[model samples]
Target: MALKEVISEFRLYVCNEWISKIPSHRFRNFYYRKVMGFNIGKDCSIHMHCSFDCAKNLIIGTNSVINSRCRLDNRGTISIGENVSVSQEVIILTADHDVDAADFAGRSIGVRIDDYVWIGTRATILAGVTVGKGALIAAGAMVTKDVIPYTIVAGVPAKVIKMRREDLTYDTKYRRLFQ
Candidate 1:
């Protein structure tokens, strides 16, 4: 393998195996910012057991809380805005294979979660999806396309179930001990 590939693999290994197990939020955030080159904002808490595909392509905003055991696939860019709540086991993917291609090649598309968006537990957000501001994704939903602002989406392929209250003023400032 090439040297760049080797270094990327080593970084991924260190992130998944070591950094994800650390209990201290400051230490993990330090490593993520300083070493991995992720743009994590202030007052954001990413809990334990979260893994990343690549290091540099992730950007998380302020006052957001990412619960434990989430898989962040940042092969493309994954931009999460402020006051977002990403629940446990949520998978945000930015890369996928083209099924119809003759060579079965892969494609990378960014996933954008706007400000004050609440992604429920175990939700799978596929590539090229932009979740609008204040949108609520229901638990275990599979989001395949762009979601409208202030709407509630659910079920497979994630259609809009109902419109959410537009006057959302809650802040997701969760900082639990040893999570």
Candidate 2:
């Protein structure tokens, strides 16, 4: 690997594996923004144990709360809009290897989560999926496709269960002081 690639890997490991585990919100936020180069908006909180690959490719909007243990693979790009809630252990992936390819070539695609989206605990969002505004993804759901706006999806493959109100207005700017 090139020197730059090696340095990037080392930085990612230190920030994601070690520094991210720190319970201090202020310190974590400072490190993530100043050192990691993530485009974080106002009042955004990324809790402990959250792992993000390629921090520069990640952009989080205002009033968003990312709970603990969330893994964000930002190898391509991940854009999360305002007032979003990402529950614990949620995994948002932006890269995957094509199984049909003989060489197992890796492919990456951007993942976009629009405003007011709520991703429940332990949910896995696959690569290239665009979660529309005001959508709710149920806990443990495996999202493999685009979710419609204001819709609720659940199950293993994440099928649409219901639709949410477009008129809904709520703030999710909550974050713990220390941990």
Candidate 3:
């Protein structure tokens, strides 16, 4: 094996071992913010200084890259798919206060990001949102509802700015939402 490849593999092992040893409460409180409770998938890249509240309700897929300081409160259920990339400071909040103010904090919802979705920097994904497979959510977007599969959305209350037209069909390699 190449030196670089071996080094990289070794580094990953060491990091994973240390991360596992980290007390979920201690890390979750200050840095990781309750990490041991969450189900972080294999080969997932979680950058430093990130926080997750609902470690119990979180299921991250393989090869996902979660950038620094992304907060996911999976009050209901937060499911992130494989090969997804969430940018820095992105907040995926699954809990919400009751809009009908008679009772506060009485309502909540879940968020789901399907496989291969790209979430831009500083975007806020509100409750009950399902970003479909291969969807591109632009930076700083306020995703209020379900994003369509293979589409690109942007702006506050994110709208469908473009639908992805790839050379191969969704059934080919990145099949999930379509087919």
Better by TM-score, candidate 2 or 1:
1
Q: If ranked by lDDT, best first, what sequence of candidates would result?
A: 1, 2, 3
lDDT of 1 by residue, 1-179 (tens): 99999998998899989998999999999999998999999999999999999879999999999999999999999999999999999999999999999998999999999999999999999999999999999999999999999999999989999998888888898988997
**lDDT of each structure?**
0.95, 0.93, 0.71
Worst 10 residues of 3 by lDDT: 170-179
Candidate 1 lDDT score at position 113? 97
Better candidate by TM-score, 1 or 3: 1
Error of 2 at 30 (Å): 1.4
The 10 consecutive residues of candidate 2 with the worst lDDT sum are 170-179
Give the per-residue lDDT of model 3 (tens digit) for 1-179: 99976765554344344543443422422323343345656556566545555335777787777776677766678889888888988999888788779767556687899888889999999989999989999999999999999899999889999887543222111211111
Point out the higher-scoring one by TM-score: 2 or 3: 2
Candidate with the larger lDDT of 2 and 3: 2
Q: What TM-score against the true fold does each predicted structure earn?
A: 0.98, 0.96, 0.72
lDDT of 2 by residue, 1-179 (tens): 89999998999999988899898988998999998898999999999999988858889999999999899999989999999999999999999999999999999999999999999999999999999999999999999999999999999999999999998689999898655
Q: Candidate 2: which stretches are off by over 4 Å?
A: none
